[model samples]
Target: MATTTASVMGPHQKYAFEDTTSLLKDINRLPLFMTELDPTDGEGGSNLALEALQALAYEGTPFEIASNFKQQGNDCFSLKHFKDAAEYYGRAIAAILQNDKKKEETSGENSTDKAELAETDEHGSPLQIIDNCGPNADDDEAEKLKELVTTCYLNRAACNLELKNHRRVINDCAEVLKVQPRNAKAYYRSARACLAIDKIKEAQECVERGLDLEPQNSYFKNLAIKIMQREDYLLKVQQQNTQREFMRKHVVRI
Candidate 1:
């Protein structure tokens, strides 16, 4: 399937049409269904396109509005709005990834966290952390923030998946679980990473934990079944390989 790769430049440039033609070209690297998407004056999409969408989003565009609300809701996780912080973090990472966010990282992993930040938490210090989603809030804004923690992690995990950083994805899922232990998506991601690294037993364990946390989650249930099947298949393969090797080595010199 075609994927949305990050621009060599930043999201600001990307959103500002600094290289519209190239962006469009990259967008069209493979076949797409943008047939229904129209550009103003038939000029094709540009920074104007993004701004227009942002404007519509602000002006009651249901989907955009929902996203905005969700973002706002993401702000309620902590009394300090850790979810909002995570969204900002996601945006920052995306920006640096696209080159729009340019804060220096604590250690420059992706220039995510600035070299100097005074942010401290329950852990007694600040760390370059990201999350998938957060808990629920009674207020609208807080609810939005609470809902984003799990999703934010899933979104970031996707980026890691694209980069083939399966191990990092596993760690990201771990962070997701810290916020909400019942996060099925996080477990799915961790299992996927385990499978990628040939840790079938580990993947099975993660899936099982996920299912136990949410017995009704179809995703987790399906994943658990799939992991068991894979584990069995892997075992069969190893056994077959062993038998073949033994046969070859021990066959009488006939």
Candidate 2:
């Protein structure tokens, strides 16, 4: 003879439970099971609970939430908080991926319904469409997500460079280039990372590619100069070491 009631997240509304084992169990599973919810209104109280949970995560759509995270990353980057910026960018990327996955699932379900409906259509079937579906479906949102993710990768690369994580910088820059082949900043960051590891030829190639994309980029030009200087310094050191070895081997005979 116990009663339990769920409450909305905001305000002083609290639920009282005497033996609410089922409700407590569901609340515990909210984080893991929320993503599995139908998102539509048919799934009883679970759907409503999922919506409230999502609203608590962010105040808008997935794209908007991802954009907000990206902006936060940029703000941290501007203040030179490289580690914090990387974390924010990571969250933004996760949000975008999660959004895309949900959209794909919804699209698949709609496509199945439409295919079934088309079988019984007298007038070529009334097209059943999801909110975002088809070839150009959410294309604008797709492009925005791509741009945001690319920017985040490039920004994270910059942070890695500042942190002297040269290998990670190279990897992040490579990721950006995968998304945006002609990104000058990606090439620039990759080139800088290559130089840090004494990858002269790779650095040169990166700089050349970057300069090919942006012929008048002062940053690329300066980096190219620095690479040339480092190469010269390395060559001089190598020659000195070779001479020292030769003298040590022959002078020992004398």
Candidate 3:
């Protein structure tokens, strides 16, 4: 008895299939298909590129998009559009926050996977020989994100200062300082906001902190001078008022 393979095609049989390249060409002909995209033309193209970037922002990894938003915020700030700049910086901060959450989730998943691998094969595990005790990809990403977040906060603080939103300036500067304790711009911006709202002592403290961070910063030096002058003027005014009150109360028979 002769046995034959059951899954074989006969000699006269041929598989019916369309050409993949032709199919691809046909698909590309569709109006909605964007086979070719140019991102450097005419204010960065029309809605197509904009919509694509927006989709990427929603779907892609957060760092690049967040950085892009930061650059946009800087551009608006250069043009002195404080409110618009603040909005852009706010978007960058939101993206970074989302990115941090995603990283935490991924780290948790990786840790669980590592644990399960260890349990399943204690000797054969690759991690046994080469332990990665040093900084990892996630750690680098986290540091980069921290820098970006600090920059965004500082820029937002500048915008808030320009808008006369003193409380918001203080808040943003404080946020920056949380990530970058020696940031002179954060201290200076916070101090400026404090001075704006008549928190003289707080403003002085911020100035001193900034000066300690960057003693040669001309802006901080100028601000320190301004604060001192303002304080002197305030003291002079107080003394004049006190003298006027004394004369009024101790008036003799004149």
Candidate 4:
């Protein structure tokens, strides 16, 4: 004959129970998600967890992802892990290019403006102009992305230099020059890479450009002297070779 006692669970307890149930459901699905993200070949739980963390970290705006990779590249460079640093830098560059493509796709109407801005002076233009932003444009985000791309290229060039990847270094430096021709470091790095591969004339051009940008840079001055000496050495070797060829062709045999 007595009424049943009301259930003692509070609203908060009910919500907590629902949350726990939802979490359990998610946990059940996690293995499938992980497999899709990174199919493992019998890797341990720790490795799986690390892969999951990396996948999460990669979820962000393109610029954010690029910045993260660029920082990782800088850390590796500081540790003298040139190969790893170069890989990270390459990833950063890819992310930046992806961002650029997205912007171009979404803002096709602005293509004319971008083309006009791309016509700025190679050595004297401001970053805004180089980035296809008008000098008066107030788009801080575009400027930042441009700067990040430039830095990534420059840093990758440094990593290539350390790895003795002279051609890659020159290519990376050339990319930076395309965006920021006044970047003395880019010029210097290009010069160094050119000299490494015996591109004496190219090296001299880079050195001169760098000197134009940074007249007081002792590194550029020293590099200029080295390029000149290399040119002289090559000339002497060519002359000697020519003389030997002439003797071989014209001298009488005993």
Best lDDT among the predictions, by candidate number: 4
The deviation in Å at residue 39 for candidate 3 is: 23
**Candidate 4, superposed: residue stretches over 4 Å from native:** 1-46, 100-138
How does model 3 score by TM-score? 0.61
Model 1 residue 206 distance off true place after TM-score fit, in angstroms? 1.7
Candidate 4 lDDT, 134-168, residue by residue in tens: 34445686778778878877898898898899988
Instruction: Quantify how close model 2 is to the true structure by its C-alpha RMSD in Å.
Output: 13.2
Who is ahead in TM-score, 1 or 3?
Answer: 3
Q: What is the C-alpha lDDT of each candidate?
A: 0.53, 0.68, 0.68, 0.70
* Candidate 2 local distance difference test against the native: 0.68
Question: Please, what is the TM-score per model?
Answer: 0.47, 0.62, 0.61, 0.68
Per-residue error (Å), model 4, residue 18: 43
**Number of colliding residue pairs in each model:** 19, 0, 0, 0
- lDDT score for residue 201 of model 4: 85
Looking at model 1, residue 65 earns an lDDT score of 38
- Model 3 bad stretches (over 4 Å): 1-56, 100-137, 244-254
For model 2, the superposed segments whose C-alpha errors exceed 4 Å read 1-60, 100-136
